[model samples]
Target chain A: MNDTDLNDLLHTAGRTDGTDSFDARADLARGRRALARIRRRRVAGGVLGLAVAGVIGTTAVREYAGDDTPTARQEQQSSSGVEAVRLVSQPLDAGSYRFGKVPDGWSVQGENAFRVTIAKDGDPDTHPDSFIGKLVIMLDSNAPAGDEVTHHNGREFWVNSDGGGDHTSISTLTRDGEPAGTILVQFPNDAGWAKLTMLEFLDSVEVLEGAQPSVG
Target chain B: MRATDRDAEFVEFVAEHRPVLMQAARLLTAGDHAQAEDLVQTTLTKLYVQWPKVRRSDNPVGYARRSLTHVFIDEGRRAFRSRERVVAEPPAPDARREEQVADDHELRASVLDALGGLPPRQRAAVVLRHWFDLDVDQTARILNCSTGTVKSQTAKALRHLRASLEPAVTLKEIP
Candidate 1:
């Protein structure tokens, strides 16, 4: 805590000879492999976000402090059909979850406090639009396989006419010890699994209280 | 040197500094050994790609630290789990594993717990100040903050850490 203690801890972080004097060859080589894993993250490629006319930009939003708060940095682009959508993304503030147990290629995304954003294997970009969009929304309320939250008379309804696939969505959503939502999705068959994933991610959006939806 | 030669040089650089980078990765990750190692490797890999330009920096070490943070953020694009942090122990005067490591383990656990209690910025400040021995300015560079911000963060971090440790220490009477 004191300078001395902090100094002592810093000293203990490593051996004396300085980091440049280290065997950087192996470290750099390993870095390449890790690069492959991180190359397509949300950083470099904004991905299919702008494509979905109904996109959630980080734009200015209602700010209020609470147990879980979101900071919006609104960004926008033109789409064929633009619908006002608000996005509230919080970092891993509380604590991130462990993925060593989850299936390979699956990741946890969105709210860091407690969340699970699943995308089909080998599909990185546009997942939120195709399947991930739909999944997150469906998780809030279970819909039969191939169902989308269709608004009928101001009520959100989960309906799937085509009998898409075995939709079993699994996620844990919590705020102040209360379950915000939960899901266990299974596709009827693997036919539209990939599409389902994208739609799920896109539709499965979490907007803050009173987020404006822009319509064009 | 040629591009290939430069790439080789960068690789050599990372091979050695892997452990130090691992230390940074270890803190960012919380305590995941494998992930820390992976992060170290990834940090070095980018340096290798831009070796020529990166090596030109007046501070190559700073370059590597920045690279590591970038890799961390990028990786979290998918998701990021914290790594386990290690608390260093002083060697016992006598050579006894049981007597030495037991307290060392307890002390290390307390230190990590204390670190977890701090906010992310404070944790980074404490880790940079104490673990890496970077001065306020250098730590600011690593954290991408002003030196004064680093100083305040260090102060706040120390306050929290001390508060966490005070209960364990007893006042000694000098007779």
Candidate 2:
């Protein structure tokens, strides 16, 4: 259409009855909760990511100094006199899933059968960036959870950018070339350790199918 | 601002601008009410997170609108269901309207239908150029493209609209 006709048409097409009432209260409440939830995850993820990176880095340094890393020790024990010497793993529980090797101070916030929100200790509800905001770990029966795949410790994991303002990182736990679950991590823009820490955490996570033993 | 005050201010902002934001989102989503609502919700949530900075900005309204458009464009690519196409058939002419009014609405619907068939960027160009009457430079600023790209996209989109609408509508040649 000519410019004027096209303008008129576009306006008319956008016209609504204006009767659709939005519950600002409900929406605001929902928005607040969602914001809080994101805050928690980012805080928890940020802190946990840093912590894990620190631990892993320290362990690697120690191993390089000729001391055995935890995994290395476990491997040695299995080789020497045992069938399997499981490495000491701390369980971070969310609903029916248990993630082993969570560092201290990180607490599980929200959980369901499929997903769990874990945050660092303190007032994460009020502090959006508390301890690492909140890190979300979820199990998706559907394979290939994220867009990009990268290998860590010889295991393949899918990773992608969520395109959020914080530029959250999404990495999926893969089993036999398929996604078993996902880890969503958000860190401050200046946190150079974000990607490396997230990869390390995903590499070390052990996802159990059912509830944490205590919960069961 | 204190977090509580920031939150209160954001709530006020959403209350004040939700209507207009919903309108733009409705158009961006091609009249899918549910999808439009979801888009608005997501945009508002982002707005809330950045409310402190957004409030200090020169034009909060424009910021909100731009953010809404960006969210729409950004998500439309990643999600399959977010891109809802218009139905094949236009709604029947309203019996309640006078013939002229009904004709007008039908023409508008046809234009909208054609608009729906366009790719997201083309549709955005048409909306910004024809609907909002933005200058090439202004449209470029919103679309994050060069002024020449805005003119080119608007021209191409207008041509598509002309072809689709045919005899009932006419587009002047892009000079």
Candidate 3:
């Protein structure tokens, strides 16, 4: 078609009638909620910055006091250890996929035969298609690539932090009979997902027969 | 601007421009009403989060439209990686009786189906250039590409549209 014809066609196709279902009120409410979420995140970030500054100050004071003894080192090591977040012992279903455990306060946002996305409760960005700040689980035939490999509970896990360091992907081979590909879980770094917890959660995913491998 | 003022302005902007944004989104999503609505919601929420920037922009509607395109492209990439697969055929068109003439609805369906078949960026190029009547430089700015790239993309999209819609609608050949 010529330019004018193409323009006319697009204009005709893009037209929306008065009967079009668009709720401006709901859009405003959602917008308000998103603004609230942004404010909360800012406050949380400020608090975290202050806490980090306090820890640094305290550590500097301790170092100035010649507290570098073996006993002090042991105490520091013990206190700085990451406390693994445990998943709740509950079964969750997302379409054809099933989860034996999930992090507390997290709920499934979207799912298909190929992938399932889980996000924190009360997350304002409820667009299932958006995976930012969420945990996504999928199966793919691509070989698992990671920075480190660790074995837990008879299953090997590959842990790779994304280039931005904002997210980590943990992948493990699916058990025989479920799917012949790797089951991968990518979790946001700020979501309180320790490597151990990620491994445990990935372990709990049961890829059903209907599950399809996600194409790259 | 003050918080209350910003909120009020944002609400007013949404009330005035949301329908226009929805129409653009409908074209971007190739006429999927539910998806178009979701895209609009996400775009509005993002705009709300950055209301100060929206207010500062010379054209808030243009800024929002740009944001909508970015969201659509982002979601399209994610969808490509996560769920896109080869479909053997497009969905069947509506059945028509021999006596019924193919109307605007049928033509609209044909156009949307063809638009949906184009890659997301190419489809976006077509929508921005044809539906929005944006010049090449403006389309390139929204797409964050060079003007030459916009021309080539629009050309390819037009060629595809010509081939796809010729049977359903009368059209002069595109040079």
Q: Highest lDDT among the candidates is held by which one?
A: 3
Candidate 2: tens digits of C-alpha lDDT, residues A79-197: 22522212235755557655655534556666655445665556336332222345656554323334346777786665645445444545554454333444333322322223444
Q: Report the CA-based lDDT of candidate 2 relative to the real structure.
A: 0.60
Question: Lowest summed-lDDT stretch of 10 residues in model 2 chain A?
Answer: A78-87
Candidate 3 C-alpha lDDT tens digits along B53-103: 566555788778788888888778767422232346654553441112155
Tens digits of per-residue lDDT, candidate 3, A1-216, equal: 223377777877788767675566677688889778766876997799697776645544553364766754443332336222447779988966789987878888888886788888899988665667888888865566564678988989887663234578888888888868888887877665655567878999888888887533
Give fnat of each prediction, in order. 0.27, 0.40, 0.48
Say which prediction, candidate 2 or candidate 3, comes out ahead on DockQ. 3
Candidate 1, DockQ score (0 to 1): 0.13
Steric clash pairs (candidate 3): none
Candidate 1 lDDT, tens digit per residue, B62-155? 7777677656645654564344444376533433532432354444554555665666667667666766666776676556445788788777
Off by over 4 Å in 3: A1-4, A54-216, B81-102, B173-175
Candidate no. 2 TM-score: 0.54
Rank candidates by TM-score, best first: 3, 2, 1
